[model samples]
Target: MSAVTDRTEAGAGAAATAGAPVMTRRLRVILLLLLGAQFMLAADFSILNVALPDIGKGLGFSLGNLQWVTTAFSLAAAGFTLLFGRVADLFGRRRLFLIGMALLTAASLVGGVAESPGILLAGRVAQGLATAMVTPAALSLLTTSFPEGPLRDRALGLNGAMLSAGFITGAVLGGVLTDLLSWRWAFFINLPVGVTVLVLAMTVLKESRAERTAKLDVPGAVTVSAGLLALVYGITAAQSDGWGSVGTLLPLLLGIALLVAFYVIELRAAEPLASVRVLKRRTVRWGNLGGLITFTMGSGVTFLMTLYLQKVLGFSPLVTGLSFGLLGVAAFVGGALAPRLIGRFGGPKALVGGLLVQGAASFLLAGIGGGSKSWLILVLAGTAVSGFGHISAVVSYMVTGTSGLPDGEQGLATGLTTLTQLVGLTLGIPVLSSIVTARTTALQATHSAADSVLAGVRLALLVNGGVLLVGALAIALFFARGTARRSATA
Candidate 1:
């Protein structure tokens, strides 16, 4: 913000007050550290999928409860993110970021060394909450550090690229590590990375705190966290427990009840943690909805294909992971090109283009049939195209969602985006899984096992494609339409 006169006056540091926009080597270093934190968190999300089998054996996790090894992390992360994001706004971003890193590092150490399932589960829970803190704090820091312009767009694009790269690497790296080294390395791997991020973040990142402080509403935090936890947990469990089962219905109902209570509490609380007023912004609402839709469609298709590759085609874990390698490359290219796309056509148009591309990719893949020699090409091209669309859509949303927020609310804005992303992922897995189950069950009496599974995969792909197309149309009609009407007015 060195060239931004208003920000220069508002900020105190030499870095902010410089006149020549301070596009220095040092600022680039800061950007890398912030993005590294993003990669760290993203890697953890996929790193354990291949390692879960080994983790189960090593820790004696029963098959019934073994899935929680992964679920626990997501559950805790989604639960506390809103509260911690607002807490960072109220307290200090940098302070909370460093603390989160420290906690995550410690949790990693505990999980890495754990000899018992209980201990590992506990570590995962802490790691999840720590991730909650770091994600929003780090993102808000990046948003606030760079002025909202080409520079910030470039930074956000780069951040999105690293995030995509991390997911690919994590999926592949986990299989490699588990085959060659040990599953424990999956948890231990974050040790050095987390520490380095924490240390570098202290140096390159400047402290930014809200100008005004509000009292933390403890009751609201508790209700909201518990509510979100139950909601996410219920959705996740729906795949295994059956949506109509008592186990699933109970938590889901409780989650809804608590969430409603949280709304009431927030309305009545003195100095509410987060005001519903932020939703008044058109960009926030549309950007978040767009995010939720794209992520759900992307992850849903990927999950279905993974099951198809492993179950029907009998592909090894390593091969399945390597198959996604092209996606990372395509995502990097898209991320590099996104800023230019936004500059030319604007964020809303870029968003519309992205969703269309993703929808087309999903549709193309939906046509792949069993025993076709063309399956390989279909998987590669579909994933590559989706990669381009996914990164572009994500980067555009990041820019559009946080575009106009004041510095004081950056944390909250980022928090909502992160929250939507997790919720989308949490719900996507089960939603797609349930669809596949129902379709596969229906075909079992009429078809072979492999054919049933293949048919189910195709059906899931169609559903994913249909959803993405609907989302694209929504973006075109609502958000992108505003862009066109504004251009006409101008």
Candidate 2:
């Protein structure tokens, strides 16, 4: 009987060992498909930026209407993301993801073949809506599949890296495609990638939803969605119409009022789109604030640098895109290192350290002024360092935000995270652009064109650094207090 038992144990061990590799392979495939989709979505955010000139010229877009191509996408994405995220939780993540991919494919086709501005803008809106569906659904699937701990952290780290890479690569690719091929290829490029991701996702991704389904909160959804739409539209309008203008203030104030109403509705609703309890969690609150700061300051600094590179330094679009390559490489390294750093130092410390590093790097870039090659070196170094810290913070904040949440609520958590990201991205450039525009205009009488531009950019960079430092300090204190409270209970 002892001999028979030993032989059975050995057989079980062998079976388990054989199955391990299969599971590993399966996980890898799933991660690839998900990350591939994420990369495509992120890339779309910046892909058209460099090609905007070509797009406007090709389609005979008026200067007034040209900005709508990008604005339409941002408004739709920001407005619908939270609603779709909750919908994904109630329905199915895989189903939503597949549907999003299909919509993206169709949108890409429409935009690629569009002969008029209206058609292209319509396609952009559809693409934005698709992104709103895909982002949270994909993120929730990842969190649920990976389980909480080192595995999830590592996955999030890679996700952060891919996001940074996608943004930079989109800028580069947009310029190259517009310069070498045609601006239309920028839209066409998504066709094959989207179709492939959609097909593979259907097979690899398992459907996931909340364990206990509830009725959709229609009022909460309507108020929150409309509020976000108005808010984003107002922010974008502020870039051109001035912050004090009726075009900006009307929507901004209305958005704020609607959001406040949504909060009240959620408090009384049977099934809220986003649970107030979850939002009240210390980790979720501070973590999202950190995310918002990092994205806003990071994107804002990049925009300023782009203007400096082009207008001040006289670099072409392609050359300016290439200049950001070092930043992309550093972002990859930061992403690869984030999980290990989080394991060694804990999430809060890692996040604060990243913010500090990024702040210091932005401060360094504030020294950029001359059009000399020496200034180019400063730009490269600053971007590289900032990218590393920025991506590290991104990964850490994501891990921090989603940590300790129930699997059922991962969709809401990720939606909030993605919402902050979109908000930051939408708000960053405009806010900083306003600062630079005002300062440059003020200095134009006293300084040369290059000098005034450089001064404005430098001041903006300093503001970026200052904001990050303040944020890091606040988050550090907040986390420390939370830890002390937990210890006291223990």
Candidate 3:
């Protein structure tokens, strides 16, 4: 009997050892497909920037309405993300993901062949809506598939790297495609990639939904979606219309009112779209705040740097895009190392440290002067350093934000995190651009145009760095206190 038991145990051990590699391979495949979908969605946000002029010309878009091509996408994506995220949880994450991928592929085809501005705009809107469905669903799938530990950390790190790489790659590819082929290629390029991902996903991905589904929260969804749409529109419009203008204020106020109403509705709902209790968690709240700070300041500084490169140094669009290659490489490296850092220092500490590093890099960039090619070296160094820190912070915040939540709430948590990212990206450039414009206008009376522009860029960079520092300090203190309380209770 003893010999028989020994043999059974040995056989079980051998089988487990043999299956380890197979499990690892499967996880890798799943990660790749999930990241691929995320990368496509993220890249779409920036892919059309360089191709915009060509699109306007080809599609007969007026100067005033051309911005809508991008704005429409941003508005739909940011507005509907939270609603779709909850919907994905209640219904089916895998189903929504496939639907989104298919819609994105079809929308790309429509936009690629568009002969009128209206047709192109409709396609852009569809792409945005598809992205809203895809982003949270893919993230929720990743979080649910990987157990909470170092493995999950590594997956999220790769996700962060892919997101950064996608944005940078989009800019570069947009220029190359526009200059070499045509702007239509910008839309057409997603075809093969999307179709490939869709095929692989259907085979490799498993279906996942909340363990206990609840009824759809229609009122909560409507109010939040409408509010977000109005808010995003107002923020985007502020770039052209002054902040105080009726166009901006009316929507802004209406959005706020609707959002407040949504919250009130949520407090009474049987199953809230976003659980107030879950949102009150220390990690979720502070982590999201940290995400907002990093994305807003990082994107704002990047835009200012772009203007400095193109407007001040007179680099062409393609050259400017190429110059950002170093930043992308640094971000990739940073993301690769992020899981190790988090394992060593824990999420909160890593997040604070990343913010500090990013802030310091922004300060270094604030030293740029006017009319000197030498500043290019500083620009490259600053961008590279900031990119590293920015990706690290991004990964840390995501890990922190989604940690300590149940499988059921993963979709909602991911939605909130992604929403912050979208909001920050949408609002950062316009807000900072307004400040720079005001400052430049004021300085134009006494300074040369180049000097005034440089001054504005420098000032914006300072604000960017300052805000990062403040946010880091706040998060560090909050987390420190929470840690103390937990330790005491334990």
Candidate 4:
């Protein structure tokens, strides 16, 4: 695929981009396959949220074990992503991508036909692992395919938009399919898409790998995967088990221990799965930090709003999904504009502005409770603004994180990018919900149930906004300033 372009009139910047990768007609096809994989994986994260009730009902899951429907997927994703990133470098990106897609196809089929909770959970875990394998390879391929310039930024922007759209669509599509057809269709839908991506990818893509790859770091991979899995599980457990309980604290502590061991192992290993040197770069470090905040706050608002709409406002699953779909549209718009914004304002400036927008929106939402349908305007507006902020930050931070890596390291770099995002999203729920629960308890002691929920939501929104604002400032001061200019030139 030739990515070369004719841009004589695009100004001096155009000439500067001439040396970047060129795409022929096949370039578009390659991009579609890559972005399609991205959309599929991202959608899987939220698609099942709406289908969970139906799935649980059909499978006869107990309340205690029910959450595994989602958690199993999360655990596999968080745990295996980094390992698979390194694997892509050592093996081959295209090979891994195709394998991952095939895995996803099989997983979807298994999930769709599952007659038992165990089978369904197994399918979800397989899907998560498959996603972990695919994401890094796809990101590596996309980033390497388009060299750094307007093209790369635009590509990343579009990729971000597709990701946002898929996430938003999943929330809505799950309900629509579940209500009209069956929850099994949620899994079935993935089957065709996954297979198509795999087939097209086979035809449209060439194999790629590190020019000088080394042996895989088995210990580092195992320790890190186990460490992340344990930690993520602990973070999730904290929501239901209480942050201070043994169920939460024990695995958390163990996870901490394993992670410490992993770091130690990496420092000594000749070829670490994830290079400590690359991670030490300021952009990589801060980008992940900023990404963590953006993703956490952005996903946090959606999670809270979903609760408010369903529990407080008594919206049906379909209505709730459709309501959030508006946010998705806004997100795509923001994503489309991210390239121009980054080009004009630079990544750091854009990152700051985006975070600020999200913070302000969260603050505005604090007082927006009480299930009155009249409040829909405020809800939609707040969510729309927040979604814009999120997509903007998402693109900016991804560029920041992956910039300057050699081709061989791109997989590891993107793996880290994905790891931070998934972790942030995974953690957002427990952290924000905990605050809301506490406030709701305090309010319920004295106020009407509806009033208490409203009060609780208001307080939670305040905390969410405050934290985002703080995170924004931290990113601005610590990560954004000098790199923006350099990346622009790059």
Question: Candidate 1, 57: how far from true, in Å?
Answer: 1.8
Candidate 1 per-residue lDDT, tens place, 402-462, comes to 8888999999899888888778777887998988899999999999988898888888888
lDDT tens digits by residue: candidate 2, 1-490: 2677557646754665665312244567778888999899989998999999989999999888899999999999999999999999999999999999999999999999999999999999999999999999999999887757777888999999999999999989999999999999999999999989988998778899999989999999999999999999999999899999999999999999999999999999988988999989988999999999999998997899999999899999999998999999999999999999998998888999999999999999998877575588999999999999999999999999999999889999999999989999999999999999999999999999998999899999999999999999999998899889999999
The true-versus-predicted C-alpha distance at residue 11 of model 4, in Å, is: 20
Cα RMSD, each candidate:
3.6, 4.2, 4.1, 3.7
Across 123-207, the per-residue lDDT of candidate 4 in tens digits comes to 9999999989999899999988877767888888988888889899899999999999999999999988987887788887888
Q: Which window of 10 residues has the lowest lDDT sum in candidate 4?
A: 1-10
State every prediction's TM-score relative to the real structure. 0.93, 0.95, 0.95, 0.94
Find the candidate with the highest lDDT and give its number.
2
Those runs of model 3 whose alpha carbons end farther than 4 Å from true positions after fitting are 1-23
Q: lDDT tens digits, residues 442-462, model 3?
A: 999999888899989998898
lDDT of 2 at 224: 99
**lDDT of candidate model 2 versus the reference:** 0.92
* Full ranking by TM-score: 2, 3, 4, 1
Q: Which ten contiguous residues of candidate 2 have the minimum total lDDT?
A: 16-25
Estimate candidate 3's alpha-carbon lDDT, on a 0 to 1 scale: 0.91
What do the candidate models score in CA lDDT, each in turn? Answer: 0.86, 0.92, 0.91, 0.87
Better model by TM-score, 1 or 2?
2
